[model samples]
Target chain A: MKIVLSATGPGFEAAVDERFGRCPYFLYIDSETLEIEATDNPGEKASGGAGIVAAQAVADKDVKAVLTGHIGPNAHEVLSKAGIKMFTDVTGKVREAVESFKSGNLKESTGPTVAGHFGKGPRV
Target chain B: MIISIASGKGGTGKTLVATSLALSLSENHRVQLLDCDVEEPNAHIFLKPIFDKRETASIPVPVVDEEKCTHCGECSRVCVYNALAVLKTAVMTFPELCHGCGACAYLCPEKAINEELRGIGVIEIGRSGSVDFVHGVLNVGEAMAPPVIRQVKKHIFSDGISIIDASPGTSCPVIEAVKGSDYCLLVTDPTPFGLNDLALAVEAVRSLQIPCGVIINRSDVNDSQIEAYCDRENIPMLMKIPLDIEIAKLYSRGIPLVLGISEWKDRFIDLFEDICACVKQEAI
Candidate 1:
């Protein structure tokens, strides 16, 4: 089974061994199968329509599933259209999330929970 | 006349230069300061403008009636921004990602989708003694800023000199703020990172075909890489702010350096005059 993991956001960065800081997308692979493909979500990087670029990269990989913390509605629509399954709210390390997926514990996400904004609230 | 102060990287004193220049200019001429950094606005903290008027900034987003939505995914098909999604049980609208382009509402065949205003921010017009200040504060978790920036520009005084404090980076937000200005002051430091990003900002402003100058901050800390770049590119180095610990501490406390050192006021006034001279020469 080919799996795509979104490795940014809270509770997932520590599990992922790779660190390409600025790129919005990341790819994780199955060690035994050696199947590899992934993309960064560019939309989260400093605004603009960078999400479309990120979506095109994911579509090119033709991955089967996405595991990550949060998936916005914009990226969600694109991934769905490409027939890619999305799994959200995967906590702890990247390895653990992948393990949960392999064990059939992970479930598909309904959609983005709190829209597209990232980070905390106002200072005052 | 209009002058835009911009930095290619964040925390590089774009607002500092803008506010000080506006204050110095206000003594002799009417000056309006427009803070176009909607995401993390700090000018209001410094200016403390007594807001005379306030208006909500909004943009149209597609709103769907769940009862009428058939989960057919038609609205999601034509959305370039990916703002609409049709799942198993519901059709969702992501307001943050929505650009308010009205494409989804226009393409909906069921007539269930309607355009509605989404509160993204607020535009405030205020006065601080002689200087007029206008800025926008983007609501928390709001992704859109261009519309709010457009609102800021609407308050620009046509006849008086105006200084726009633009957002950092060479991105779309920076471009939107700096566009249509008579001149642009690209603020940068003498470090390697500053030089690299300054080159990128120069390319951005040059592409817009605008006359630009450089202001090197923390001039005494690093080597002369930025100065060398400006010399090589023939872009004049308009002014320099030395590496002073006192200035840094003042900045941390949300105070302009010129307010502490009176002599610095004359330097900014001269810089503004130089920018005006450059623009006048360009017109010929």
Candidate 2:
């Protein structure tokens, strides 16, 4: 019933970050009640393997799904192996994305949305 | 003396200057030219050394013994590279992220981790005319390059002049190649990107306390800025090669500058002597 969305800040109104790894915070929201709890993403300051760190952190939290703008191959693999469903390219703020997911408007990702190290490049 | 040719920006003629200097120096002194770029080592294309010795370059990675592992999470917690992940049921190792520092295995309290050598590349040693040649070819899909660069530098001869051909950028690989050299020749153009990266390369070289000089390729393309930089920094402008269609044509044909235009031989020799002077001045 709990799902995680990569977010720029720690609230339902915070914008959903395009980058799954290196996103500042992850908002954990219970799908039914819409109650939210945010935790700092460990991968935000990691020197390397940001994707792996993020995915492992999510897996450890026992999140049932990940909703974000993009996901790299490493994070994709870790999440896939952990049996967590990924719904990427989900735009809008965290609350909107969760609402869309609840309404079955978001599509599930079958594979990685970007190449490895895609999140680490200059944001422009 | 060990002189390394490095350019902060790619295609600014690090290999060109390195091979020319090595070829010219070989005529008068024993010279060893090491292609330390490892990732895209093209000095061999110009030197054409028939490799007589080839050895695999490897680095040690941790191998966890699951039977003895207490799942204490020590190895994974200690890894700075994020190469290891310890789950409740299993411990995973991503060797590609490993820098081979042996920190994980060294810090494992349960003594469940052992080290194993993983081949990352191959080092080739050969001779091109009188110049001793050495280079490393990193394996495909391998992101690690410093290990292979280190392997190439291992072949440096103490009694002769060793010229290391460093890759572009002031990253770890460039530092690995330029470190511990008597003199570093930073090749660049007169453009903005060239000057920007040149400053970074100079900072890296200066941090190591190594004496360095600049070689401006296509010196006619842009001027006052690069020259002003040299003047302001008090770094000598050792050599200058103008932008010429003939030089470009010859380079396209894989011909060295010294070989394409015999007059350039003495120029490179002068460049070598200038480097020697700088090295001696630094020592004094």
Candidate 3:
């Protein structure tokens, strides 16, 4: 199955071998299986919009699922509208998050944890 | 005429100079004081305007309808700001990143996207003694401020003289506030940090082609690098405030130094007259 994993921490990248540096969002594509790989969410930076950008990256990769901790409303809306299912509030290792998704044990988030604007002010 | 008071670096007495000039000018002419520092606005703390009218500042953000969305990804692709996106099974919208340009909605093949008003800040109109005061307050966590600054500028009356307390820094917010002003007062200190940022501000104002004068605050604290910069640039040195702890204390207590010290009122009065003369000469 083509799956997009949205990891909140560096752990998500630790679980995967390939690193999509500086993109905020990572796209993993399985070469042999021809399936979409997992997507990682590089939590919010001090400058804001990291989560939003990460989610957009996932959308750009055409991911099917987002696995992370506490997806905010802004990110959740974008992912859900893109037909991406979110499995949020899952703690522990990034490998576990991917495992839960593979095992069909990860529960879908009803909605984002928080709503409203999230981003840093203009960088002067 | 509209006069903008700006300092490239924060806490350089930009508001102090602006409010003092406005108060002095209000004695003889109809003066409007506009606080354009949307973030961490402190002019209100000093001016203490009695707000007569208040309005919510809003900007457009994209709203998507799931039923109408086909997940074609067209909306996301058309968004130059990356405010919208399409995943394998769904489409996503990031309101914080949206500039509200309505391009995504206009290009949406399914018409699932629509523009909705999002509260970014508030604008207040009030009276501070005889002067009319207008200011913008960007809500906490809102990334956008130039729009709110634009709204505040629209309320400026052309028939009278106005003083805009611009935000610190030579950035977008400062540009929005200083643009279209008849004159800009670049406030600064005598320190190296002050001179560095002042140079940046000079570049910003010069790019806009707005004639500016420099006001050296805490003039006695450091030597005259700011003065030297103005001399080299041929920008007029309008006035200087001596570094006095008493004055600082007065400011910290929310008192305009000109008001706290009756003897210095004439100094501010002269400063306003000088500004008026400069603007009048520029108009010719």
**Which candidate leads in lDDT?**
2
- For model 2, the stretches where C-alpha displacement exceeds 4 angstroms are A30-35, A64-70, A80-114, A121-124
Candidate 1 per-residue lDDT over residues B246-275, each given as its tens digit: 898988887777787789999999998899
Q: Please give the distance, in angstroms, between residue A44's alpha carbon in candidate 1 and its true position after superposition.
A: 14
Give DockQ for candidates 1 onward, in order.
0.10, 0.46, 0.32
What digit string (tens of lDDT, one per residue) describes model 2 on residues B1-284? 99999989989998889988889989889999999999999998888998899999999999999999987777867787878777656677888889999998888898899999999999999999999999999999999999999989989997889999999999999999999999999999989999999999999999999999999998894777998998999989988999989999988888999999999999998888888888888999
lDDT tens digits, residue span B1-284, model 3: 89999989888899999888888778888999999999877888888999989998888888889899887878766666667666656566667777777888898888888888988999999999998999999999887889899988888997988899999999999999999988999999888888999999999999998889999999884656777778898989999888999999999899997789877778888987798788788778
> Candidates' TM-scores?
0.71, 0.89, 0.78
- Top DockQ hit: 2
Candidate 2 docking band? acceptable
- Which should have the higher DockQ, number 2 or number 3? 2
Alpha carbon lDDT of each predicted model:
0.76, 0.90, 0.76
Candidate 1 structure quality by residue, lDDT tens digits, A1-124: 6766655532334444221212345665663474544544544453333444354445556567877666655566667776778777666666677778888898787675335333222212
Give RMSD to native, each candidate. Answer: 8.1, 2.7, 5.2
B177 Cα displacement, candidate 3 (Å):
1.2
Positional deviation of B198 in candidate 3, in angstroms? 0.9
lDDT of residue B213 for candidate 3: 92
TM-score of 2: 0.89
Query: Candidate 2 chain B, which ten residues in sequence have the lowest lDDT sum?
Result: B84-93
Q: What lDDT tens digits, residue by residue, belong to model 2 across residues A51-122?
A: 877887888788899999999987887788778999988988898999999999998999999987777756
